[model samples]
Target: MSGGRSAQAAIAIILAGGRGSRLGGRDKAAITLGGERLVDRAVSAARDGGALAVIVAGPAAAVPPGCIGVREEPAYGGPLAALAAALERPEAATATETLLLSCDLVDPAAVVGRLSGARWPAGADALVLRDPDGREQWLAGRYRLAPLREGVTALGAVSGLPIRQALSGLRIAWLDTAADDVADIDTPEDLDRARARSELGAD
Candidate 1:
């Protein structure tokens, strides 16, 4: 609550809302890598990134034990839908800022760590990570809560507003990192690449 930013009360929503449709209906959240389920890695990433609480937005029954799994409002909609559902939750209903995360990410902890230590300008509304290219990885970004309604409005007008477009006109921190900044386990090839990269980094 330091002048509208969370000192230690930040809220984050892990958008584990998808069913991994592209992965042939596998539960991407539960997929394991390096001896732990994918969701666990994502959770750890958020916690490590400084989220006090993380709402696993997906099927309640599928969430692993010890994780607070809440049902996504519209069930497997778009990223905007997932964000809207998170805002409805009591925690985000009054939150000043919420960092949104995607489950299929391979290095949740890495991304979170970089983002957790990020600095923003005065009155910043969102902190985003972008690659050297201009593609906005909205799924892997932090956003302020006050403009959440704007995100909702954008989603309604479009099938799915790009995460960056939703935060237009707000003070934003556009972070630039390597291509791995927003990498996720979306497909078999993506998974293989991530694993290979992990192996390379370890060596």
Candidate 2:
């Protein structure tokens, strides 16, 4: 991990350990898109977007290549708890900002692009991308680490703290993206649709 460099934009982390009951219980980050692993897509996009360090937060089952592995600290708790755990990652100490990955998006690079061009205002606690389709996706977002830690601690469990709540005392930026961009790989139907779309060159 490098710090004090003008090029170091933020510390990026991918939340990949979700037990994907969708997509036939397959690991979403490991899912392939355009012949490249989804997690790899995320890493590449994040690095290209200026991440100084990249971390993968997920289960021990199978991890994608080219990232520092991170698991939820509370083991099986929700995202907030999982992030708190990830924040404690040895490599996380140098991260100025942290990114939460949905692990199953069709366009990770687009997601990163949406976030990179956003205006993270002063007092802006965190920024969550609004998937124009209406889902408030936690992944594909930018976070101000310091305030997140405070809110998570004050709110008790990490899962208990909502992104809104953390930004309650601060400003938040929303980067709108296409529905297909944030569409997750959940269920065989979704997977099939993804494959079908891939064949059709849609998305």
Task: Note the Cα lDDT for every prediction shown.
Answer: 0.71, 0.69
Instruction: Give the alpha carbon lDDT tens digit for every residue of 1-203 in model 2.
Output: 12222335477877776667655667777788778777787888888778777777777543555667777656545556667777787666665677667667777777777777676665666677777666677777777777766765676656545544544554566666778877767787887787787778845
**Where does candidate 2 stray beyond 4 Å?**
1-6, 159-170
The deviation in Å at residue 118 for candidate 1 is 1.1
Which residue pairs collide in model 1, if any?
1-7
Model 2 residue 6 CA deviation in Å: 5.3
Clashing residue pairs, candidate 2?
Answer: 17-58, 22-187, 23-187, 80-158
Candidate 1: 10-residue stretch with minimal lDDT: 155-164
- Supply candidate 1's per-residue lDDT for 46: 74
Off by over 4 Å in 1: 1-5, 61-66, 153-165, 200-203
Q: How many backbone overlaps does candidate 2 show?
A: 4
The TM-score that candidate 2 achieves is 0.82
Best by TM-score: 1
Candidate 2 to native Cα RMSD, angstroms = 3.6
